[model samples]
Target chain A: MLLTATLSLLLMQQAPSENVDWDAEFGVEEVERDPATGEIPVEPYEQNNENAGAKPFTGDDMAETFGGRDGIRQIAERFVEINFADPRIQGIFAGHDEVRLRRTIFEQFCYILNAGCDYTGRDMKSSHEGLGSRKADLNAIVENLQQAMREQDVPFAAQNRFLSKLAPMSRDVINR
Target chain B: MTPVFNHFATCLMVAPLALLPMSLCAQEVLSDTQSIDQAGTFPEYNAKLLLTNAVSAVDGASGGGISNWATIAGRQETRGVGVQAHVTAVLLPDFFYQSHGVALGIADRIELSYARQNFDTQDVGAALGIGQGYMLNQDVFGAKVRLFGDVVYGNTMVPQVAVGAQYKRSLDGAVASAVGAAHDEGVDVTLSATKLLLSHSVLVNTTARLTKANQNGLLGFGSVSDDSYAIQFEGAVAYQFSRRFVLGTEFRTKPDNLGLGEGDWFDVFAAYAPSDNLTVTAAYADLGSIATFTGQRGAFLQAQVAF
Candidate 1:
């Protein structure tokens, strides 16, 4: 009878339960009391907070992630370096030195980041103010952006989101 | 003394006789009709001339010849002002009727028009009437400006284009408002590029219209949803056999917004000028209608007189 009772108890323990045992032998630490407000404990940023259940921010992790400012900067740099050879851009920015090109790339990057910086480089209206660009020029810009995104392996979803925001501006930018 | 007097008179008479042939020769040379014909052919006029007198077909086809006749006449003499009143009465074999009123070329730049359409099918059958046959009417007032001229012929600087806008309002407000329309009034702006391809004997005109009006100023105003924009293309060619007559054809496309009409229309037209001021035009038009309504073809006639 004792052996059978013990076997029945072991079978019951194998069933699933809604309750979680934090004090089990799996190495999870248990807190006896909550930390006092305004008197926080000093812990490393990466350490998982037992009280707030938050993880730390790391620059290396940010560099690995393909979003936010760091990722945008990297993508912008690659795009400027690779697609600057496009004929459309060459025609529009003819006689522009490397410094001007770099400045334009930086302005684009800043605008994409929404970093609250003044993009003194002319808006679409002023940049194409009197240029009288045709539909071909607008299409060429879209193609160049697409190729740059593909070459840099920017995720498809991110690229689509950017294009949706950029597409409507074509009416203002292309006049011919 | 009497003999000397006779000699002096003879010398004077001989001198007068000698000059007569030279004067006659000069007059004959100067009075030739060739110079008069050349002057008559090329007269100087300051007003804009109409190189052609043709309507833009529904499919964006230009009628034969250079329809710029209207523009040319408007620009020729500053006092040469004219108004055209046109009423198109369309009778469908199925008993539907449409009518339009046009007051065009007022001030040589502004045009005002009104159109009304009725969809009646009682003569056909009861099955054609979904609920009640309605008479739809629209009022359109248009204003156009001749911003610049000689766009095609001038140095390749600016395109020969004209910009205009039409403001339309529907008469059946209750019915038009019930369809989730944007407003009772809609405005459509058009930029038309007209190029004279002289080598091809053709005028290729393309108009990009941003419009929210539903029925081309028919069915009253604001009957169409606001989410529609159309690009209409028209090409017209005229082979002139003589100075007074021309035969031509046109093809054009209109937007199908209300799902009550056919896709596009085409026409073959011939025009004759009986005099410098009077022009008569006749055309066979195929204007398709809504549904399986075939045989929507008809004939068109127009008379234009300019002073």
Candidate 2:
């Protein structure tokens, strides 16, 4: 009788259940890009134009200077690219979603420059949380952005006008 | 130190890079005690926007060409230390003036500075019977603490404020006493406020000083006729032309306690920063007169480095 009991326990251990989900049992969760935006999903948060962090320029002069929506898109793309490649600040951008960042930054700049776009990103404080940005890092980013804008032949004065709108946002962007 | 100025000439021919700290009203710490810029993934570095720290003044502190501002003398932000060195030459019709010094900044909060000033009387020395080529020398030691506010950040209405002290000691005590000076050494107390208006691309600074020095203490402190401290004013207004160029004017009032007709100092200066670490300033200074010699006006050139 003891031998029979031992044989049954061995059979139970060896049996494989075809209906079982091994991944669910192992606690592995998979994330997929949204088919509509081609960006990964983030936590749901309320979005508003205030999330852009500054009031948009009312006139079209700035928009035209930045080459309208097309020019701003190019600038945002180049800015992110430079940051990811820079040795000093690349670590902060590393592991973040490039596609999502490019889209959101473009939206923010477009909305601010009055190039006519809506910002759907989180507020600066929430977005920068845990990223650990410093004053030096902010300056580096500024220089890289300047380089990108220069490549687009943006006037230095116009760039400063745009920067004035964004300069105060440092209080929110830098993690104290 | 003038040799360093030579490097400035070739640098834009060569190379390329603070704010009045965005200090809060409640900030009292000598440094940023908290560990910021460390937990982040960003690499360590020192960088401030161009011309934001201002230039080293005649006294060797971070300021305009002739006026002291509420700025620390370094390129550091909130995390680390920085330093600056400067050499200034002022050529007047009757006198030759030069100053050189170095300053140390700690955590963008406190500043310590030392400068040596030499005033060459030239022909006027012979006229005054002090021997031709007579040089009046003094060492100026300065310490400043940022009381509150920021030059670059925060509300535009708020400005950076600082309190400082300068101790001036003349090396020629006997000559100074023989010339009717009450003392050969003195202290200057100063309170300064500065702000950068971004929208206007302008910077403004004002300082109130309590001092008893004659010709900034090179001619000695006070005179036998009037040995009392006087309230003086220093003011500067700068217009930013670009990230690298600044045009400004400064006026500094001095105590004429020596009663030799010392004139208030004035200068119209143009400063260019070829890179973050290098700034070259050239100005036309009108010193009015020194030691009864009239029309002391000419060129003032200074080269400064910060890191």
Candidate 3:
């Protein structure tokens, strides 16, 4: 036992310390570089999309699956109810407009589902730019979304299919 | 003593067989939520935490590519029981090495593992006058318990630590004795520390092993030339590129007492988890030298299933 304790201490000492600044270690610039100036090159979104290939969901498919626009609306309402009640995510809605928020969420889901809904809500990046959202918050929303879909009798496969399409949006909503 | 050791190894091999009936019994008592995934209402069966835990290593302990780590296998749950099985194949230039094992993780604390390794000497056996296609078999039983700290949310400076031991016995005792091995059975104690720097999406683990094994007990334990326990180090660093993919490299130091010129091992690997229950790892390993043969480099493939 004493030997085990000594070896544990030695191995722990071998690990890298927390004080080392990784950003500095990698020589990353403290200031953000603009891509237009080519200081920090950013890959074109089109190229990224090319690698990702075509998305599976389409307006016609989503429209048929959700019974056109009405089913999407029902899903939206139930999602809001779950979000308001879920402690993990309820705090994010503390000061939001209930009716408008529901409408926005409904439109967002419809658009992601490619249900041919003319979503009038703000763009995803702008809407979530300053909420200090983390991956934890996004995960909470996903959990609530799953619960809402369950209440609405959505098949597990269908839920996953929808989520796969929407999962990429995390880059825009989290840690922005 | 040898007969008793063989009996113990046999018992370890049969333990998994006994677990089958118990697993079926437990299934009968599964909660409604546990059966939700089976009913096709839930897509995920295990939903504790993401990428916070690692799959079982070839030796059946939770770790990186080839080295044992401090973290437990399966998803991160404070009070959950998890079990995993793995099949690993390492293709060397002059030998084929394979290991199959099962592990049990209890309440995110204790880990018990058993692995059986087979080393096929291929052409080397003929050259060494040990008969054609001679094989070496060994059984390793490991037990580890987390001692302190949490890798994911530990104090800024401390890493998660665990203390473990592996009792290994070679089945080919006669052949082991011919190779000048001092003993056919030996025990190894290990201390492992692991840390995940989520901020940088990097994972690191360090382990120190106190052992007398030669070539991981395939060549047997200790030797006529050296009989004391030797300290070995294994280290790994991985980058979590995405939720499902991890790219890593490992370095493990080995003793050079067996006169066969065994050297340290290194590998670069990529592990992919399609789901919480299934993982596949592919690696290019440079095992340095084994049995006097130089540059034993080859590919490694491992597949694991956990619940």
The Cα local distance difference test for each model comes to: 0.46, 0.83, 0.73
Which residues of candidate 1, in runs, are more than 4 Å off? A1-176, B1-80, B87-92, B95-135, B151-159, B174-184, B220-230, B291-295
RMSD list, candidates in order: 36.6, 14.6, 21.3
Which candidate, 2 or 3, would have the higher TM-score against the true structure? 2
TM-score of 1: 0.42
Here, model 1's chain A TM-score works out at: 0.51
Q: Comparing candidate 1 with candidate 3, which one achieves the higher TM-score? A: 3
Greater-DockQ candidate between 1 and 3: 3
- Cα-based lDDT at residue B277, candidate 1: 51
**Among all windows of ten consecutive residues in candidate 3 chain B, which has the lowest summed lDDT?**
B22-31
Q: How well is each residue in B142-198 modelled by candidate 1, as lDDT tens digits? A: 554545543223322233455666666766665445544445667767665554333
Candidate 3 lDDT over B1-307, as tens digits, reads 3333343344445647776333232222233324444445423335333545586666678887679899876553444577778899999989999999988878778888999999999999999999778999999999999998766542435788999999999998888789888999999899999986654567899999998888888888998889999999999999876557889999998987678898998999999988867889999999998988999999999998877
Q: After superposition, how far is residue B2 of candidate 3 from its true place, in Å?
A: 46
Q: Which candidate order results from sorting by lDDT in descending order?
A: 2, 3, 1
Badly placed stretches (over 4 Å) of model 2 are A1-30, B1-45
Provide per-model DockQ scores.
0.00, 0.16, 0.02
Q: Which 10 successive residues of model 1 chain B have the least lDDT summed?
A: B59-68
Task: Please provide, for model 2 over B1-307, each residue's C-alpha lDDT reduced to its tens digit, 9 standing for 90 to 100.
Answer: 2322343233323332012221221121111222232334445455666777788888778898888899998888767688889999999988899999999877768989999999898988898899999999999999999998878766567888999999999998987898788999999999999987876778899999999988888878888989988999999998888779989999999977777888999999999999889999999999887777888889999999988
